[model samples]
Target: MRFTIGKLAKATDVLVTTIRYYESIGLLDEPDRSESGQRLYTEDAVERLAFIRHARDLGFPVETIRELIALQVDPGQDCERVDEIARHQLGEVQRRIAQLKSLETELKRMLSSCEAGKIASCSVLAALGHHEGCLHDEHGGQEVLAKPPSI
Candidate 1:
């Protein structure tokens, strides 16, 4: 079935702006325009949008998704490349999990030290003010800790 941009977005559960952005970024191809200039999409667009949504939900970057789309178009390509990308994403996820676990540990330590006094004596505030007071030495020393949102 054919769909307008709105229908496509609704069908794929992706926002219209995001779909337009994807098109601008070359992630989604520009669809044919209707008689009055409205964008028209087909079943293939639905499938492609679904793939893009799923990849994004899995935390795959746009460039990686583009590569995967390229691979999808070329059926004869070796699956090894796809596997490599997935493995890389897995490693990143594992690393983040480890980092979150460390953060959890540090938070617990900070909370445990709190004696329910004023903000001056609050362990959480003290830790925030003085990183050196943290029980975990590696708490804020990593480069990742300084970086903004990655995924």
Candidate 2:
């Protein structure tokens, strides 16, 4: 079945602008237009958009997804290269998970120690005020107070 851009966006749960941008980027194919110039998409587009959205949700970058799609289109390639991509993505996810755990531990320590409701005695406030109290590294500690933590 064919669908309009709005229908495609609604179906995929992707923003209309994102869909257009993907088309513009060569990441997605440009759909045919109706007599009124409204974008018309086929069931194949629906499947492609679903694949793109799923890959994005998996935290795969657009560049990586583009490569994966290219790899998928080629018929003669072995499965080994696909395994390599999965491994690379897995390593990235694991690294991010580790970073998150560290942040979680630090946040738990900071939040648990601070008194929230009191006017003058907040553990968070104290930690923010004292440089040594911050768990960040030397340059990072300075950066966090001036600029918010990356997380």
TM-score winner among the candidates? 1
1-151 per-residue lDDT for model 1 (tens digits): 7899999998998889899988999988999998999999989989999999998877788899999999998898789999999999999778777777788888888888889999777778888888787666674336435553221
Every candidate's lDDT: 0.84, 0.78
**For residues 33-142, could you state the per-residue lDDT of candidate 2 as single tens digits?**
98999999999888888998888777777888899889989778897887898899999777766666666677788898966678587778777678687575443222
* Runs of candidate 2 exceeding 4 Å displacement: 116-119, 136-151
How much lDDT does candidate 1 score? 0.84
Q: Mark the 10 consecutive residues where model 2 has the least summed lDDT.
A: 142-151
State residue 73's C-alpha deviation in candidate 1, in Å. Answer: 1.5
